[model samples]
Target: MTFLRDLLGIPGASSDPAALAAAARDRSGADPDGLPLAVVRAEDIDGVRETLRLAHAHHVPVVPRGAGTGLAGGALAGTGAVVLDVSAMDRIVEIDPVDELAVVEPGVLTATLDAAAAEHGLRYAPDPASAAISTIGGNIATNAGGMRCVKYGVTREAVLGLDVVLADGTLVSTGRRTVKGVSGLDLTALFVGSEGTLGVIVGASLRLRALPERTLTAAAGYDDVASAARACGDLARARRDPAMLELLDGLTLDVIDRAQGTDHGRRSRALVIAQADGPAADAEIAAIAEVLGKEASWVEQGVDAASSDALLAARRLALPSIERFGKALIEDICVPRSRLADAFAAVEEIAAEHRVAIYSFAHAGDGNLHPIIGYSGEARPAGVQRAADAIFRLALDLGGTVTGEHGVGLLKRDWLAREVGPDVLGLHASVKAALDPRGILNPGKAL
Candidate 1:
């Protein structure tokens, strides 16, 4: 324990319940009780290595944390262990415009990288909802997807390489900058969505794409949630590659409108915001508008750069806006594209059956739905748990995943086996045993 103090001073190891409570929860706001004994802030790669070694020796569970904006509670600290806060490691190691790549430390914010790339007329495309605050390490660990995932893919696609420190303080680089390489078994990809189970990411070399020359955004407001699902399905079927396609139901709109004090409550709207970049954007927008018109009340087109950007920003604010109503148990589930409508229908039915308020929104193009349930008053632990289980089970019943972009942190740990059967869960356990045999790296998560 003294060695631990040598690396991370014990003078103020942060045993304060208030500080620990804040570190206990994530954006999901689900059962934030298991607070860690100490919060260890690492300022450099050596510091992270030293901290991991001490934790390994002392058999202390280490939960790697980024910006603490994780919606899945993946960064939640474990009891009587250490919380590894990497936010202090913020740094941009390198930016090679000619190579279309940027090497950044784990703590660098996603939006910060995007802005740096913008200076060179290049952009990082994996823009998650919390890009402004979420760190690149969190994005890489979660393999987070965003509205543009319909066209650009998720964070895993943008990351070319990672500099990881293993459980026992062994440092290694997975993947490379070369455009193509098959020398290894793609260990880097393994670590991308591993949720910090295999190692602690110190830095990453990410791929960047040229910024779009022109952009057009259009919003199609549907009268109901099902119709909105139909519009999303149609676009996917027609092979329309809109950069961003999101849906917000009436309840979601009402919450956002009331929260933001806007006039967007005239209809039961399932709004779809799409972006068409490049020279072919005009024609693409036309086809998209025609398809959306089939199911929406109206397709409002905004070609002006400012107007389109503003609408996209507003759409991103949906979840945060919805949080104003009550405490949220945000459920992230993804079904197949064709099953999007069925998923929405099932979600609506479940909310009605349980008599709970659910506001839905999603990257509909990819079939990733977020059914955020509002719970106020006294925290009925059992009731809240039941509603979340029902929503996740519905997604699994429809041949969908229990989680889309969000990882199986503390919140969805119970439902993990439901989505991935016992056998697969066992396989995951075996891998976990091999990588972190002592189970010191973020134990009781994703297992």
Candidate 2:
């Protein structure tokens, strides 16, 4: 308590349940426990530095939180820790339209930054589905990916420079404002997905792209998931890359149709929406449709912005809509593009074997799939656990990762050893020891 007051300059840092509750449960809904000794709302970079120094000296675990929107338990607090809430530091430091770059505080929301970039005819393209509420810091921490990642890349690609506060209160700047540079070791890349295990992110300068002049969209309805998966495989083999390619199974489509009152033009057991920009947009959509025709039940094209947004909104609202049924345990798994069909088939098999309801969706352009297992009542604990284990084991068997975008927070820690061998885990521990020997920064996360 004394450390929090002295370093953060906040009087009530010791007593605040509302703030603690907000920082405790992320989107994961992992059973929240162990209230922090205190919550520190850092207002600026200096404030972050001061808190770290105090924490390092006091040997108290510091859990960094941003908007608490992470699908993983990355933002969940541990026992006897200080919850470092940075959402209060929201601010845009600078925007250079000519250079196509923007400097922003870590607390700024992802959607807010993208909207600001649009004013200059430029945009930051690494948009996770939770862009409306997720923070840039959390995005960087998880190395988030979204629909456009098939073309634009992930959060790590957009980040040009990072201002970080080390465990010992040292402030370090990595990368540059320029387009390219190779001066030293890529420390910036190291911290991007470290999940707050290495340091506290204070500020960042992000790379931006020119806004698209035109966008062409199409929705292809398939007879089954196999058809959609096969179409994705064909596109990859042909080396045809669309700006966005997303898949939604019928179970998910049904939820969206009921919740959002939207229509997909045709009833499809499996659906894929492909989008492209520039003058070749129409051609790209046509080619994607042609490739999907081999197995599609029906195919329709959406040309105007309104229709496109509405179609995309259905895909975006899938999670929330599915949540209406009951609690959903989302599984994010990624396999090699060629093996996507196999992965999809494995998920179906696991659901059948466990007798559980699992709805599937994904950024099919890449092989990142989200398989959500729904639970209706509390009596099915054994069934839910069995389903989760089966799906994760299936992912590992297919040479895919347990988590594609979300970090290995508390929930996925047990799977880490199976995915990466003991030697790699040892290396991770060595690095953690070198940076944070005290283990006072987001302990039990990542490594």
Top of the candidates by TM-score: 2
- Mark the regions of model 2 whose C-alpha exceeds 4 Å error after superposition: 1-8, 11-14, 261-266, 377-380
**Residue 176, model 2, lDDT:** 96
Worst 10 residues of 1 by lDDT: 4-13
Model 1, span 128-218: residue lDDT tens: 8889999999899999888789888999999899999888888899898865778968988989988888899999999998888888988
Weakest ten-residue segment in model 2 by summed lDDT: 7-16
Q: What RMSD, rounded to one decimal, does every model reach?
A: 2.0, 1.8
Backbone clash pairs in model 2 (N, Cα, C under 3 Å; residues 3+ apart or in different chains), count? 0
Q: Which tens-of-lDDT digit does each residue in 180-289 have in candidate 2?
A: 99999988998998999999998999999999888877788887888888898888777776899998887788878888777652487888888887667778878877
